[model samples]
Target: MLEPLGVDATCELVYREMLTHPGEGVAALAQRLGLSREDVGIALDQLSSLALVRQSYEPSGRQRPVSPEVAMRILLERQSAELEAHQHRLALSRAAATQLIAEASEAMADPQQVGVELLVGIDRIREWLSQLATEIQGEVLTFAPDGAQTQDNMDASRPLNLGLLQRGVRLRTIYLESIRSDAPTLDHVRSLIRSGAEVRTAPLLPTRMIIADRRLAMLPVDDHDSGRGAVVFSESPTVQALHALFESVWERARVVGGAPPSSKDADLAPQDAAALKLLAEGHTVESIAKRLGVSPRTARRITTSLQDRLGARGRFEAGVKAVRRGWLPMRD
Candidate 1:
């Protein structure tokens, strides 16, 4: 425990030996502790600096151990004062950083220069997103395509999303309907909703995009291969168009928790509905099974059930009938 106060084991041993053999010289203490004379001399220097040991004029200028109670109190007081001073400096640094960031953002806000930056690799995208989330001033709009998010993705996103929410930034998100039955993703969505975010689901989404404060937007450079890289758009017109596309889709999407179950959709469970929506999106039975975490046989059975319920001949007709009956919300 004394190590935290810069007291090493050797120093403690030397001090203990000095305590028992009061007014002992460093050589005598070294012999009692079975340590080298050089080691004992170093320990003596440290203990003296900490006021844990001192050279006594009596007894031929030998060393004497100070009372630990007094020594420890002085060390703690010094530590506390240093900690407070460091904290004060840290706060000032943070304030300066915030001002510098604001100035940099302003400098980069030129309309003539298209702020289209290419971020290569997932690591770069994640890093940029983290920094962008912290600087978001008004709102964050996201179009999350694909199926249910992986646990790793959700874990990575939680801190950034929650930080933005805590800062009073409005969060509006649109997710693919296929993820509606995803337990982990659904749980994460519910938590965000509780934190004042508006979340919705649709049968299909155009692409994965994130727009922050209506000023900047980011989308994968190649939608088919997101790992390739992503493009960041700061041009006002392009960002506005992306924002509009999100709003249009958001208008038609069903609210995750607030939308009341339609009487037509009530006949099917949430997972069943999600499966049907995925099927309607041209997803194969194997892919559907994978997304739903079920067997291929179970996925085929679900399709059969939808076909029977809609009185359709096949998968395509079933999809058409489901759309007509308003049982599934399909993106045009």
Candidate 2:
């Protein structure tokens, strides 16, 4: 019955037994439930991890079940928060799907057009990207959103990126501001910087993109699924517009590991401030953690700290106070 809340049958049974027969040892409960001692022990461990049980303060080292009134409430709240995050993610997926459908429809309507080409599937996307990389002559501008890049992605792009740098081709990439705290990703960025690539970070970015030599641009077909495919644009107006967007973001983004951010960045640490903005924007803590590339615990800590600093009772209030104090620019 409690499975929906992630309480397994054994754990729930053990919990119930402990509640009705307070202070009973594992062996006794194991005998009563006709389960192996190991099974009962494992259930206790799971319960402990869930905070449904704790070590007894008495001389005995047996586990103590927390009152359901308190423990269950916390579990329910956590489940509710996760549900909300799922809904928010679904909404984002729907919007991305709509955009993809429109772009695909347009491309289909003009089969002979040279403006847009839809490359459908990972293999096709990689082949096209490789072709673009080979043809690129002047510079490559990119937005690497969706948190810290995976090691596999970094490894795959290394040869291509190194080749560009070797040819003295300018390569500038913007990543999410949260990646600064990720050790491996940060090290990778530093290496790229040393190899003559320009790298910066912003608190938020609209989507993942790559523009080659101001002649061609690539955008993800689905923001959440990189392997799905991408849409390439070569039309002068479309490429030019994408270029303008990159330039605008580049002007505002902070140089990775360079000078301290400008005063306009406000009082909070850049990452924490970014987290606060996300919270205010109605993003769930789980989503915030993913965007920031930090653990949920760290995200929660940042949120709590921001709330304290702003003297706000909750995340929403903290965002309002931050804008009021000029910590964050008021959004339109």
Candidate 3:
């Protein structure tokens, strides 16, 4: 029990023995406790460091063990202080994260002198992506919101991805949770995981993105049709902002093929939670289906199921009840 208070078993045993046999020296205590003299000495050293033992008034070098009451009080005070410091640091970090996110949002809404280059058409985008992939030295973060990927897309990406992995580049990708039901996409994800890539899935994503070396970010000009064009941000507020967005989503996303998040969104499945969010946002069935990469029938099924679970008469009531039940996040 005292282990939680930072006292090891040996130290605790020695401390108890010392309390019982106050007049006994280290040798006597060691013999009684069945511990070697060296072990006893080490335990005493640990106790002294913890202030559970103090110098005895006796001329002999033997140390006197502090009373249990005083020792425990000291330990509790130390623990409290450490916890306070930890919380303070966490608060500071939270504030900094909030500031970064706010700045990133503003930057996206109205870009500043942020170094940016717009590449129109699939050919230009692919050319720049290839060039950037070769230049990357550290890591790549990607948000694949396009739902299910085509066989050709997967095949074309393999060589570049494998080359980066061989060069010891860390790659992390977040795909839509809907892809779990798609065999081809799942197989491609598994292959990437086998090659030392980390993959996760989220219910919804804001856009398709790729950030390389924390210095450049690539975003699709149009989410529905990426072939239209792309925007490449280089070492600017916009890139930093996109990185922040990736990190925020990554934290809430679930690991592919792993167990669902425990107790989050009141234990609702990721897809269920996503559906509720979209419903609350007043998205039509068609729009929700497109966003979730599911067919209209499946989207309707999920929506109907949500309404039934919430005992709601319609989509409006379902959204209201979902918010009241804490099953979905509140949006402004």
**Best lDDT goes to which candidate?**
2
lDDT of 1 by residue, 1-332 (tens): 45544577898888777778887776777788899999999998988888887778695877678887887667656544544465466568867976874564454444454676777789999989988987899999998876678889999998888888899999999887766667888999999999889999876576789999899999876565778778788857889999899999899788987666678657876657778877665567997776555568878888788878888775555565675566765322
**Pairs that clash in candidate 1:** none
Which lDDT tens digits does candidate 3 get at residues 159-272? 889899999999999999999989999999999999999999998998889999899888876677777677777888878888999999999888987876787445678887
Task: Work out the TM-score per prediction.
Answer: 0.54, 0.66, 0.64
Q: Which residue window of length 10 is worst by lDDT in model 3?
A: 105-114
- What CA RMSD would you report for each candidate? 25.0, 16.9, 15.2
Prediction 3 global C-alpha lDDT: 0.82
Tens-digit lDDT track of model 2 for 148-258: 778988998888998999999999999988888788889999999999999999877878899998988889877778777787888679899999999999998999978
For candidate 3, the per-residue lDDT at 327 reads: 81
Worst 10 residues of 1 by lDDT: 104-113
Model 2, clash count? 0
Native-to-model Cα distance after best TM-score fit, residue 303 in candidate 1, in Å:
2.9
Q: Which TM-score value belongs to model 3? A: 0.64
For TM-score, candidate 2 versus 3, the one ahead is: 2
Clashes of each: 0, 0, 0
